[model samples]
Target: MEEKIIAHMTAEALYDFTLYHTYSKFAGFLTNVLGLAVGFMGIILVVTGKSPAVSLVFYLLASAAFLCFTPVQLKLRAKKQVQLNPEFKGETEYTFDEEGITSLHDGKELSYSWGQMKKVVATPKTIGFYYEADRALIIPKMDFKDRFVPIMKLAVEHTVPGCVKVR
Candidate 1:
């Protein structure tokens, strides 16, 4: 049986998905952990009066820099998505079957065999099909009328090794 999905990509949805994907990676996790460690050490130094002012300043600067960087980068990427794919502003239709998936966007159609899909990355609100490490086709979860998660899972199983679902 073929499953059909029709959805529109919004900037907000894309932004959320990008942020989720970014922080779910090892690098992002490490950055956050290091930031917290630095912050705690700063606090400890202040309490102990060992270079208190310097430690506090360094902690604040480092924490703020790391925290603000991701959001800003995500915002820029979201904006670029809008600018680059004016076609995606409208509804995108996807048809999935045993063999592969076909997508129709802004009057243009493209088909991809199951084997062509390298990976499936799923989040609570979206599922992204990565053809390459840096390129993906993102679909919002809310776009499906029914059986959203199961359908995606089945698709991933059919096409790729496994789906990586991020919390």
Candidate 2:
């Protein structure tokens, strides 16, 4: 397997993350919880059989909050990767080596040592490391050749055996 690295994120990656992580997981949970809360409010509205205004207000507030969170979360996340690796202007060839991982930024190369990582994760989607939050270098999982996961996972595991194979 060819040694791989994180390049600039593709549109496909952003779309996949928004679709799977944002909608399926986050929205799903939010909707379920809000559904229950709304149902109870609806029941209260009917039982009281008065003040349709109360029900309307509750629904509007909940809906507004939900709408606000989605874009805000996406923006904050987008801000982070851009800031953490200021040199990552997209599509830069990130080189991973024994000393550190270096990538070109503003025509200069910067390296991040393995010591900075809390741990490395080999997922079906990317080679990610959790430095603080969900910061990871997502690569096309499909780009991997045979046993790519095993080899990548092996290298990190050899260096930091504590890395779990969540892939």
Candidate 3:
């Protein structure tokens, strides 16, 4: 009934994230394919010898790649890191009944029943649970205890897109 969370996560800071397990290996696969595309761009910039815009385009592509993938990569890395070592320990065991979610990470806690849940999604490496329109709780596997098990069937009821189908 208790769960934990990580705070102040950053690119440089390394932490295990359980969600990384869902996608790290796959990320590697994507990295190779994407790297090849980058290589093609490099060839266009070098082998073909185009205009000054070529260099600008190269820089733009590099910047775009960095901007697009770093956070996602870090999310995966942090999840993996949490899988190795956790930082936050959220107290999810307070209560889930009518009084609802009394434990707080800092000093704030909200009370809500399962009926309040709106959506749930298990992406490549992260499990997302949406309560309202814009708020969500993302949990990674590495954040869990070593080999912790989940009740996936019941958990599916709370995801945004219901990625986990209960049988």
The model with the greatest TM-score is 1
Return the TM-score for each candidate structure: 0.82, 0.54, 0.42
Clashing pairs in 2: 8-91
Model 2: per-residue Cα lDDT over 57-145, one tens digit each: 67656756655666566666656655564543455555555554565646877566666666565534555544544554454455444
The better candidate by TM-score, 1 or 2, is 1
Question: Which structure is stronger by TM-score: 1 or 3?
Answer: 1
lDDT for each residue of candidate 3 in 1-67, tens digit (9 for 90 to 100): 4433343333233323333333456675576567566656666666566635457567557646744
Off by over 4 Å in 1: 53-58, 147-150, 164-167
Indicate the TM-score of model 1. Answer: 0.82
Q: What is the alpha-carbon RMSD of candidate 1 to the true structure?
A: 2.6
Task: Summarize candidate 1's per-residue lDDT along 17-108 as a digit string, tens digits.
Answer: 89877897898888888777877778888888886576698887887777777888898898788668776588999988787778998888
lDDT of model 1, residue 149: 58
Worst 10 residues of 3 by lDDT: 93-102
